[model samples]
Target: MDLAALGDCLGTSSCLIFQTVGGLKIGLLMFLVASGLTLIFGVLGVINFAHGSFYMLGAYLAWQTMALTDNFYLAVLAAALGVGLFGVLFERGFMSRVYRGDVLVQILLCYAFILILDDLVIIVWGEEFLSSLGIPDAFHRPPLFVGGAIVPVFHLFIIGFSTLVAVALWLFMTRTKWGKITRAAEQNPLMVSALGINTSLLFAGIFALGSLLAGLGGALAASERSISSGMGFSVVLESFIVTVIGGMGSIGGAFVAALLIGMTRSFGAIGFPLFTDGLMFVLMCLVLVLRPQGLMGRSGG
Candidate 1:
């Protein structure tokens, strides 16, 4: 507790360790949002500008579900499943037709979806910022102290849950039959079809998975920030930055990029209060200039 000792700690690796942990938390959330975006783009070949809207829906749904059910666990499940089902409908009824269309057209359609979704949210949620779902009251547990720092149980849950999701995704993609077929479709849709795989169903599955990730991210973020109509638009840009920096089609790339960006933004915000919002973009530009395909992306694929 001595001031001199504290100063020494702050000036050395201890400060970096704290920053890294904080950054890792941010990176985990970014991964949740960007992972879905990357998968949808990599597999379905859709720009999906409205991915952030799905995140917004998840937050709103969490608010509504918590109010109705008064159970955080149930609210999270309902939010994820509801958003995922909506994604399935969106993909099948609308995005399916534009699978192989021009990239600009896809972006236009997604942008339109964004407008429609925003209006729908206003109509349903009434354009007011809802308070944080009162997670502290809901959990009512003692804080976990890490090196004298108070850590919220909800954040611990996010870290554990995201890790589980990542592991499950890795196992599914590498060990399961459905995952193999999906990866094949990502590589060569025509070849996959020639091998007797139904690409349509596979695409639908991927879309659902992507939406599920977005929904989880939204639900988790709602615990940190009030649910608002504009939150999606604000966070989506950060998610896009993570996806681009990580690589479009590589889940591993997304994970790494998310952590890097998360740490950069966290430390940058603390060390350089000015331009905190633009730190991630600056890093993205630097990475792109050095490695156009992203940190883990395949070039000319």
Candidate 2:
């Protein structure tokens, strides 16, 4: 090929690769947020409207921790633990009572919690939006050269970290004794209790784990977007859409749906411009109408 043609080909290839990688990163973030909502709704039968509130709490906590210690890594860890603890408290104190209630009641309870959390957040963090938590200055290494493209080191870190988290969650859910017990409880709580398992504790543990995942998602998102109070409502809606699009109880489904949604959003924004968000909703509605049970969801009752 001539020099101009070769350069054009290379540029097209690089752009495609960049878009793919960017979509994957966005998908991973969606998975992180949706996984928790799915688990909480699937296993505990709690809609957990406050799940998004926990995500906001995580971002605020991470911001505070980073300010205190000047360490991003430590801030993430602290945010996870703090939000996880909050989840435990929420489940044990309020949610446990509504376990056997109807979906409407559960939703009402969660909505009340949401109102409380919103006020609490405002009281603590005020109404100002925080700046993006960019990667540490010390770790701003030169981009990696690949063909005619240069990829930032931070992007690599995000992809690696997300992969590690996904693998870790998979291992925890499939390999551990606790994981098996939790799954059993989800399938049949009466049977799990009859088998001598403490169902309450199991439920609490799942809630904590789910909240930790949401917290991690929020902390990671802070690196790209400004932290704000209203962010919780926006992200929670997306997470709910993702949970429904995936099977409510299927982690693999969540992962797949996340990627689909992320890529659709990314391409829609670039290609459709004015109809970006609307395009996402249209896709969601189509999925709901055509495959209500989701791609990986179990069929039948």
Candidate 3:
């Protein structure tokens, strides 16, 4: 453990701010991805193994959208919309059947989708890395000086934007009619059905909404990271860790857990590089052992 790198990260206020802000951005981004996974499980009661594939699809779709239109906003919109549409179709065509099915059945269906989606990505984008996407000029204008620390504008935007999204999601889940209905459906699908609610469509919509979140995360991340064939796999693994730590089916838990993981990794890069990758795993294990429910999740789930 060399303290040199750690000191470099903490030696100056600006360095500390930059690292801290970066951690927030990473955490929020993780929240966006994992929220969808948790939502699907919460409402549909199925562990979607194919969620990562949808995330990968969003990146490719965004790259293609930018390549063709050269518009930043459109690229983001397209990624979310395209993946969302695909999610709807996928849920209707395949996943809907497996609702409340055997765990193995769910896993098998999702695993098959992973292979199919991976092959599709290769066929569409070629087996090469994509790095053409650039930060939008509007978002690249100028860095913000905060508390004597210069922070990238894009980083601030992400933090603020993600906060807004999280708030909006919370509002939707707690206040909206559909949101209330969704919760009802989650709590008692039989009762919801008895009340003349079409649970099948509701499930499909919930699943698509989850896909949309994952897609948006990928699109947002496109500029920061290289778009590639298997980018989603690593993200999905971290997202699973987030879900587990946050509590499965708990969106609020996911948000906080993502931040914790992000900060752990970001600072770990400076002070504990050797243990960076394993830190989250250790955290996950501890949470599992000490509080199996999660930071914000309900017990017996």
Off by over 4 Å in 1: 1-17, 136-138
User: If the candidates were sorted by their TM-score against the true structure, best first, what order would they fall in?
Assistant: 3, 1, 2
| Highest TM-score against the true fold, candidate | 3
Candidate 2 lDDT by residue in tens digits, 1-301: 1445334433686655665677778888888988998888778877788888889888888998988998999888998899999999999998998888888888899888878888887788887888877787765889876654567778777778887887888898899998888778778889999999888888898899899988998888887789887678988898888887887777878888888888776555556657767867887788789988877776664
TM-score of 3: 0.95
Which scores higher on lDDT, 2 or 3?
A: 3
lDDT of 1 by residue, 71-111 (tens): 88777788889889999999999899887788887888888
Candidate 3, superposed: residue stretches over 4 Å from native: 2-12
Model 2 TM-score (2 dp)? 0.92
TM-scores for candidates 1 onward, in order: 0.93, 0.92, 0.95
**Model 3 per-residue lDDT tens digits across residues 1-301:** 6579888778888779978998999999999999999999889888877888888899889999999999988998999999999999999999888776888998999888898889888888888888947888898777888867778898888889888989999999999999999889878889999999988889889989999999999998886789888788888888999999999899999999999999988888888889988888999999999999999888884
Clashing pairs in 2: none
Given candidate 3, what's the lDDT at residue 99? 73
Cα deviation at 13, candidate 2, in Å, is 1.0
Off by over 4 Å in 2: 1-11
Which scores better on lDDT, 1 or 2?
A: 1
lDDT for each candidate structure: 0.83, 0.82, 0.89
Model 2, position 69, has a per-residue lDDT of 92
